[model samples]
Target: MLGLRFIGQGFAGLFGLIGLFPVMAQAADSRLQRMETSDAGRGWEAVGRLDVDGEGFCTGALIAPDLVLTAAHCLYDARSGVRIQPKTIEFLAGWRNGRASAYRTVTRAVVHPDYIFDGEVSTDRVRRDIALLQLQRPIRNTTVIPFQTDNRPRKGADVGVVSYAHDRSEAPSIQELCSVMARQEGVLIMSCDVDFGSSGAPVFSFSGGKPRIVSVVSAKAEVDGKRVSLGADLAKELQILRAQLTSTRIGSRMPEGVGRVQVGGARSSGGAKFVRPGG
Candidate 1:
């Protein structure tokens, strides 16, 4: 239940409401297994590391050849409260050890129009904390296939996550099965193990017999002194972000306060603890 505190902090209000009962998954939950080898990392090449302006990184997944999905908060500077420049970000597909299966620079990006990056964590913010990035070119790598997304899983369903965090930034790790502890508003609280730089990591559902992304890690929360991961319910928010991306003209200027995730800088002082971008 540890969080990427360096990226941001978790909120406290919702803990009073979520059920502590362990929501079971179709498969037994397993500890995070690092995909350090090519064989261990196969089929998960689409889950790549989002290198933000070279300052830090977050976990992101490809949903289409040119489209990547992640958290909205990742588009801001955790230290300066500034929106990042899309051109400065790089999508390192299947980053393992020191190499990647594919590399692409980000051309344009968009966050949920309603997503506010004020740097505060809350159930409301987490619910809409989703964004999509457009790669400069489509990834034609045969091994790297984009994942289709589905509605968030029910409370009784099991889920999985693949991510890159500060301690294991060189490669991604996977928790094949975890419980979807509870659902409130649009946030899916789960028993997934995650840490800093894990933001924007995709939460997958395997009930359909194939993995389909159903959520994006927004923040991590603690309840009853035990930690749980929080994620965006992708169904509705992703729809809006897609439309925004479609209407966006290449090289067009986005209004300030919107988003572009860059993981740089951090507050040298205290604030509401939530996961910040670029863990």
Candidate 2:
């Protein structure tokens, strides 16, 4: 798999995690509000961390189960700065070190052959920012967001992008939101603030009375600004992902370490980890 490095260096300050808040606490348009807050309006659960080598490592929702989508750029050779084969790495869902009940290793990755990271096509950055991972087994406990496969949102639609960015701050909690500014040249550009840790966040739309994922956060505008964009119209890539997910058999339960465990919350079945609002 090949792709661009999302946001590159210096993205930390620019993205600020504060930018992750939705433009409006709630959309004013009754129709849009209803769609965005509906049951179907959930976003993807993406886990990304800065690895020991200082590169972004990520894995996230590709479908209901059996697949984890991410940036292929994360799988490069630490020494040579070259693309690494998809087989050399692993994907852990609900990942937490030392927690046996919070992780799962991946079995395969499908990378787009045309992915490039040299910044040559800065104008059209959406082409290769996506990839898919097939888990060795299926995950069944987490909620999965539905994707919109056909038409994307028109320019200026109020959209939301969510990820477990850097560490949680006072802003952008579990389901942070943002608004879409434009969908140009294959990318869905938005003003939702995202930072280094949010590389693979899902970009979603409130359409036809329901929320649906239309794109995945790929990278940001030149770090000179706070907003970012996602790769939309990867229906071909999504088709590949959906096929893998549907073919795999659903497992009886979430593998140990393969689902979210709220960080500061009581260890109940599947509660969220709470962080003091100002902590």
Candidate 3:
């Protein structure tokens, strides 16, 4: 297990534990575009913000009509170091300007069996840092279609991300093109820009005509002095989480509280911190 590094200020700050830093200079083709209106983000209705108990939020995507995918750490309480109640979480699909295309409450959540809220950064943690949330009701809306996931992308492959950052929390931003810098262990280091409230955002690959989720944003890190975003290989982790959710009932055994706290910044209302790349 590789040790994690802590840096930055609180969630509201410019950069925090989860790595929400100033946008680094990138090619003109890779800038983030704010999805201010519904028409501006038509096909991305499945991606939305996961508001946890009205405290703070993280990015999440609907993988199934009733299943949402996000980072496991987002399910724990940053201050108390306990699992948050599933009922407290709400999925705001295509959330923009305080309105959402679809709304569903969480009935249960299950994290990867190997994930630990130990307040450390490691390949193991990042690789397995994923979770599945069962919604209170199935979102069978016509416009909000769930996304299918595929295998991880090869290094140097072009990828894209849609997320809600702290500065642009009201609306989601789309980075249509970024490159995967490297693949180590079960983690991917990519040049994709991210910030606070971007955790659990979906990384998409457009190998086919439509987009499929390839990874979930876990943290922002400085790899060899270069700013990069970290994510889990969803190919295997997503399968494991699905099995865990189906094999056992997560009703009574579910822990109560927000997820774990990362190093660097103070705890936010969501109990997680944002990391700044190259801070």
Greater TM-score among 2 and 3 belongs to 3
Candidate 3, overall lDDT? 0.78
Q: What are the models' TM-scores?
A: 0.86, 0.59, 0.85
Error of 2 at 62 (Å): 3.9
lDDT of each: 0.79, 0.44, 0.78
For candidate 1, write residues 1-279 as lDDT tens digits: 222121234233433454445544334678999999999999999999988665667789999999999988877766556777787789999999999999999888898887787745556778888889999999999999999999889886789999998778889999988978878778888889888778899999998699999999887766666667889889988889888998989888454453333333352221112345222
TM-score of candidate 1 relative to the true fold: 0.86
The number of the candidate with the highest lDDT is 1
Ranking by lDDT: 1, 3, 2
User: How close is each model in CA RMSD to the real structure?
Assistant: 4.8, 10.8, 5.6
Query: Which one wins by lDDT: 1 or 2?
Result: 1
